[model samples]
Target: MDNKKVIIAGAGHGGLVAAAHLSANGFDVTVIERFAQGTLGYDWTDMFEKDCFDFCGIELPKNANYVKVPESVFVSPNKKTKIKTEVLSPITNVNMDRSAIYDSLIGFALEKGVKFEYETKIISPIVENNRVTGIFVEKNGKKETRKADLIIDAAGAFSPVRSLLPSNLMIENEFDNTQVFETFRAFYERDMTVTPPDTDWNVYFFHLDKPGISWYECREEYCDVLIGRFNKFGEQDIKQVIDDFKNEHPELTDKIIRGGQFAFIPVRRAVGKMVADGYAAVGDSAAMTVALIGSGIANSMIAGKMLADVVIENNGKTDVKTLWKYNVRYFKEINADICSLDKLREMLCTLGTDNLNFLLNKGVVKGEDITAAIKEGGIKLGIKDLIEKATKGISDIPLLLKVMKTLNEGEKLSKIALSIPEEYDENKVKMWLSEYNC
Candidate 1:
């Protein structure tokens, strides 16, 4: 195969990982970050403990403060009951230094000969004869054009590639406006005097009565909190939320250390399709952030690996039909599961905090069991996964009926999603590509 020049835009978590994977495979990779060195790293290093180490196949320094949390507890404000479980392996929670991990990955990629340009902004995709040739970048008051065989869009939530295509352009369905939430997270020194009880190192998920406000904390010196706003909220709101949380949860208030402010992320699923003729997207750029709960690290890392494989397998092949296979496989293997989870989350959200609390406190509902069953294929998705997850614990006739109703709604949504496989005609696909519309 001819040597390939792969261009990765954005130096965020996913972008950096893609660069590392591609570089390891002998691709000539270039990573361009719009931000300075200190700002290029991600902010949530503490939430990911050992899981990241094994998942991404990276090692950490012995003195690293981040440790794995093997247990998880879910609490609902309105509900009297609480749910708890032991987290499985490969799903171990990790605590990390965002700057350290980012620097390590970037350095590893560099050691593998991956080239990088910091503070270089991608102005737009360079198109020639309707084919993507490279990109226009601006750096240090100089405008330069770099050519490449492929471009990976790993830019986070506010993706640069998003505007290059038509607004109506979609991968499977149009972008859904599910709302974005402002969130802040902090990492501190683990102070045994101020730590919460049962700190067997478990991740704590607090479900509030509010529509969007929710937070999670791992006892390992790092706390990640998110506040949902119906409309856009900023830094002030983040500070207020943190202050309120600290006051409300006094047990964790005293351990505060070197922390930072919150950032906004759309807690929505991705648009319909993920690829066009000459470009593709991964991570939050594709709106792959989970709904309800905002967890994208694992999903993005896995997507990076899958995308690398896709790009390597189809390098130099510019046809959309060949490249589009990435979409189908990704959708089937991962996105489809997320869609199901989104639907399930929508059901839970609509039920209100009262219902959630009642269900949690009054009955047996294991979130991990649901995810595990789905991953193990014990739960066939769409309506079936809901029925499986709901019925797995509920035995009362009233709750069983309610669970069945939920499953029915999920079934309806599944039918709608499944329609795409049949509705995807050549004209629609070609039209979406040629016209640059979703």
Candidate 2:
């Protein structure tokens, strides 16, 4: 049989991994990216699981520049209380520059004979009879069509290809403010003259009593600062937050070192439908980030490998039914945890500063609990643990009740996520989607 041709719509981390794996498995793979070569990733660093490279079967980049990410200090909105989390032994997380990660994945794909079309813009998917068959693209000021046996959308959260798909496909085409995190990240020169805080990393919850998070990490030469909100915010809001940080911490200097830009991240569970006839989505296009942290690198890469496995197992069949296996495997192995965590994230957004301060001040929510929830990607407090927390926070019965309600709701969501239809029956999948999303 002739080799199946795969077109990766974006050079997304997971899509690159999938391209490599598919190429290695005797499929022809091509990646089309809007950014030129050597400028494929963001101009900043990100944190992800350290073991993802091994899991994706990609070698770590030579002289990989990274540092073990220390456990973060969660500061109450009032900034009077800080809860330091316990550090995990064996160092589960690492902060690596985004460019280095892209270099590694791109190199791996190249070695596997995957072709790349740099500086190519993907306009939309080419559909016929409700099945995607190729993509419409523009390169060097010229528009053209690229045909492929299958298309993998590794595009970012706002991929036009995903947005423009035919409505009958059942795939979600848009993300509301509640499902997205608007973020501004910057790295500023550190003022050595000023004394740095004792903690290397501090995350401020509901910064300035706003429904958002802001954090600053003190590095040797620079301070990495990120301000994020669930609702839409503008430059003025960003400036206000930066000014607040500068006033609070003299170590954060005015000189910008790098990464002064705004971006959006999907902070919800994976999309209800991620596959259609002859097409599938991975990475941010699938909303595959950890809702609490907006970290998708590890999960996206893992999903890439899972997708490749499914495609190879099915002998390169790209129909919706054949592609549904990838959805089932991903939901069972990964999304259940994300779905559970999203509930907690939603609660944090609405949980006022007073209640949050109370939880921290009263030790109802401890550092270890925070660490566990992040490490495990979900909240899993047992009845005994809940009872202990309730007793400790007996004064705030209403807040405790709210926490309990969130936990219960999270459990229900997880069950629904795990119960994704094993096979692609249109009506059954539609019903499941309604229940799961509701």
Candidate 3:
């Protein structure tokens, strides 16, 4: 393909990964970032799937600061019930230094001849003939139009381009006003005098509310404390909950090494359409963050690679039909099961404390299901998977009803998501999306 000018409208992990891939593939790539130079990324590193980096062909520097999480322990609100989950694996789940990963990707993209426009925020897409021709951006208080063959918005969920798109835009739907889970994560100094817990990561479920969980992870000298609401679970005073959790864990010192972000994580499933004429989206822009875990690092990186490949294979054509392949491959092939977890989220958030305790006590919600949801994006269960629990819980009609409803909805959503069209046929895409949107 002849050299194509590609504009990446964010310098997040997904955008950086896309820049690296496209630049390496002989595209004239330029990445616009809202943050100042050298001030990229969050203070804390996000855990990700190992295969994502490999899939995107972006290698980390030898000195990349990071760790491997072996497992995570889950506890009930009262600490009476506990479940241990295999969260880390050789196949996926690698935790690394957030800044190191960004810097490394920037270095790689730079080496591949990608231009970096720091502190430049995109104002809107330059649309003409029903196609995105470029972008209108502001840099140092000056606005300019930068033309490109394709524009990929890797901006977070609150992307200007995505936001400004006309209501009639094919790729636009339900992204706005979606419930976002706001969180505060801190990697604080650990009192070396106190021995850390046996498990590296401890997760407490049904804490403060029926729908939220609190997490703590030890990274040698420091511990990572993540307190957030579970979307659709319950609305509770987050500040009070965090304070309560802190009170319980005295080992977490005030000396924070990283992270004080009031980050808003998108809890919604992937948007129905992620591509438009001459434009596409990745990462949180496309709602690529996983359903339950709220981790978009791996999904976003994979989205970048998939988008680059589609653009290259289409011979640099930037129309909706050609770019639609990126959505199909990433959604259907990589994460259809994961998308189905949204339905599971609905049931999870609505279940009362009594139901949650019963489910946990009866082994109705196993560690395997959680692992599968994180690893494969959906839990595949047969009659055998629940027959034992059903028999054991025969006396609890309310609990049984809730379980059946959750499972039925999960199955239906999974089927619908898997059958998403391979092409951006307006009618088909709209029809398929109505299942979830309705």
Candidate 4:
């Protein structure tokens, strides 16, 4: 048996990815999962499949749920624009069955000699000398202590390891209520055999003329369609909204036989720097969901890969100070541009449907324009200029200016937020945290 052991909490994609890498690196790895199997099965895009497959040297599953969506179409009440080309995004611009991807990772880890403890829940981190040595786990009505050279907290949003660490570990966090999203989605089998429109792998993003409410539609295999309504809306209202949308878009309704409904609540915060004291948190445990977009699959996989590298480089030895490099790489390399996108989302939230209509009427902001602007530089300064210029010769110019100023303040705050990297020195991190306003 390998003396160097790594214990991973959670059997999700992130945890499984980490386990696979560690096991391949000659570490005796054990994965603990709360759910037995088939728990987290969502028909969404699985960005890590290709990379994970390559890493594990295996073939991927081809199922209806695992169908790929090639491009995204941005739609408003009456407008629609499609992105023609496909980019190699970490989280692919594609969609798949999220659960199948999870299951695949688990199988890969198991084949790589990683042990699994299904129906197991991790209570807390077992710490000695302030270094995470292992975990206190409960399984099948039995409690036991398992020790490992390193512990990876791949647990979801609410991490068990966070409470054990200092609160200042994530002082630069700036997530607002608006960032959180409540969504209802359902998979429906189409009534007709005729192929659905935009059937060649297209995702529709409806910017609901309202603030905080947006929806997406994508075609799946076997005449199925994935309809998702995301934002701050009640379940009943969401169902009604979907119904109304179906009615409004007869072309969509024609192909659909019936629709089912479900809801998903997502976190909208920048990935927190919580890798400390011989412990590391990845996936939603680190609040790594994309702010405006709400994509986390790829981010979680990336974190898993990164954490594995950091652990390998350190040769199983880790501490608060030494683990800081992992956090640095997370924000700097993988998550830097995503944080900027979050700031843009905040700015857009302020510009609700009315502002969009106004921009459309004035011929100032178009979908193409916005896309080109973001691709050219970023949505920050370019949007501010457009908003300022559009409000010219109107009494609301002052109001626009005020809003722009506030929006600029938000941008500045975001800049400060992005600048707060995972610092190694406790004193330096504390000083920066104290200086940060949000």
Candidate 5:
């Protein structure tokens, strides 16, 4: 059989991984990226599981610069109580510069014969007879269509290609504000004259009594600060948060080192439908991030490998039936836990500042609990643990009930996530999707 031609819409981490694998497996792969080659990723660093490279069959970059993230201190809204949580595991995660990650991934894909078309903007998917046959693209004052046997959408959360798909395909075309995290991230020069805080990493829940989270990480030369909200926030909102950070941390300087940009991330469970007749969505395009924190580098790469495996197994077929196996495998193996975390995230958002403060101050939520929820992607409390929390929070019966309800709902969501149909029957899949979304 002739090699299948694959077109990846974006240079996302997962897309690059899939491109490499598919190319190596005798598929003609091309990646179209809006940004230039050297400027593929964000300016700052991100933390993800260290095993992602190995899982994607790519070698770690020799010159990679990274460090183990320090323990994080979760501060209450009122700042009266703080819970310090240790790193999930000594060797489980690493903080690496985003540019370096892209360099490694792009290099690996290049070595595998994957072609790249930089400075190309993907306009939309070209659908013919309910099958995506190509993409309309604009490049250097030219507009044309690039045909391919398969189109892998590795575009970020707000992908025009995915959002503009034909409505009859049943793929979710948009993510509402509640399902997206609007984030502002920046790095400022550290003031050498001022003494740094005792904790190098601080995560403030409900910062300034707002319905979002803010974090400040103190490094040697700079401090990384981020403010994220479930809904859209404007420049004034970002300024207000930064001003608060400046007042609290004297070590933060006025000089901006790098990164003062706003980005959107998917902070919900993977979309109910991620495939169509001739297309597949991976990475942010598929909402693969951890709902609580918007961390997707690891998950995206792993899912990319899974996607490549399914495609290769099916003899390069890109039909919905052939690609549905990837969706089933991903939901069963990875997204089930993420679905549960999405529920927990909803619970956190519902808990107002006062309730969160009470939980923290009263020791109803502990550092270990936070660590476990993050590491495992959801809360995993035993009977003894639950009873202890219930007793401690007995004074606030309503809060206790809310917590219990969230846990119960999260469990049910996980079961539903895992119950995705093993075979792709249109009716069965549609019915399963209705329950999964509910």
Candidate 6:
């Protein structure tokens, strides 16, 4: 690997983490970044599982920002009922400032001898024999080709390179905007002058109810206001929502540090095929974000490292057969529950307000159930809890029937995900792909 060159298409968390791992493994790695040196990611606070600190190998620099917002309470549209989960274990759900994390990861990767090309745009991949050999990049005023033994696409969810690849090489699909969670969030001045929303962090559900949700967080410096919708809100104006909140707390919204950031995050499960002969995808580009809650910082780091390890373990071969193990390990070890939860997300999102009211307000779906669902791995329900849920289901037969029917179908997906083949058998892999909607 020391003699081999690797090109990562994005300098986001996934690319930076992969660069560090590969550099540590003695590979010559270079990151192609679209943004300039400093202005890379959006202004937002994200929470990752604490295990990422140990497993992802990212060091938290002194003065690193840690957000203190607690778990949010979900208020019903009618406002008659509110649902709150106890503070998730700090050990599992850890809040982090995204900007600080980017700085630390970039600094550490640079120190590890990974090269970065700032203000570079990836034009296209240079494919040879159906294999991604390198990329054509545009920097300054000219376009130049950078060749590498392998190309890793960490270029986020809307990755163009992934789109341009020949259909036969991989599953070529466009990121439909309908599947995106279009979020416009702001960090406003938090004025102690006006009383803020209770729970510090809370969501107002059923805001026109169309497969979307909104929430807010109060930080030391600002009140974070986030409003988002699914498919593309036809006439819904999130800006107006922010304005309403601002009117309520002008003292806090008056002085804005970072006004807002609009980001479209992928809310899908992992991609079916993550590799061609000489290419692999990680992070958002790979659709690695967790389902429903839309968290991927930790998953990307783990995916990046696992991809690098698979490449190394295959004697530095970047062929499809060798790289396929990256998908194996990711689905089996790192994101197995994510696959299951993808089904779960579909089910829960399909349920109308009525179903949720019964589940959340009536305690059919206990707060502990949510705590378990949002945990890093995913939900784990014991036999006792199952019986309890069954007993409770008798009170609401129709809603319970819907839930059970959905759960029964979803379990099939879980079983398929759990039984991923150890070795890549083209036929078996093809079958898995069909089940995974390849």
Task: Give the whole-model CA lDDT for all candidates, comma-separated.
Answer: 0.59, 0.86, 0.75, 0.58, 0.87, 0.73
- Top TM-score: which candidate number? 5
Off by over 4 Å in 1: 24-26, 47-64, 87-93, 127-130, 141-145, 167-179, 188-195, 198-208, 216-231, 234-248, 254-256, 364-425, 428-438
lDDT of 6 at 95: 75
TM-score of model number 4: 0.77
How close to the true structure is residue 382 of candidate 4, measured as C-alpha lDDT?
58
Error of 1 at 162 (Å): 2.2
Once fitted onto the true fold, the runs of candidate 3 whose alpha carbons sit more than 4 angstroms away are 173-179, 230-243, 246-250, 384-387, 436-438
Candidate 4 Cα misplacement greater than 4 A, ranges: 43-71, 77-93, 126-130, 142-146, 163-176, 193-211, 218-234, 251-269, 348-353, 356-365, 368-377, 380-388, 391-423, 433-437
Best by lDDT: 5
User: How many steric clashes does model 5 contain?
Assistant: 0
lDDT of 2 at 257: 89
How far is 129's C-alpha from truth in model 5 (Å)? Answer: 1.6
Q: Which lDDT tens digits does candidate 2 get at residues 253-327?
A: 777889998898898899989999989999999999988678899999999999998999988888999999999
TM-score of each: 0.76, 0.94, 0.91, 0.77, 0.95, 0.89
What is the per-residue lDDT of model 4 for residues 1-438, given as tens digits with 9 covering 90 to 100? 255888888865667788888898889899887777666555544433255455445456666254454454444433434443233343634345666677677777878889987788787777676667788888887888888877777776555654455444552233345655555555444435544455433333343454554444435433334443334556566555556555533334423343343544344544445566657777777667665556677667777887777777877666766677877777666554554455556556666665544444444444554453233213444555756565664445654564455445545544555676555777766654554434
**What tens digits encode model 1's per-residue C-alpha lDDT throughout 88-113?**
34355565566777767777678777
CA shift of 353, model 6, Å: 3.8
What is the TM-score of candidate 6?
0.89
Better of 4 and 6 by lDDT: 6
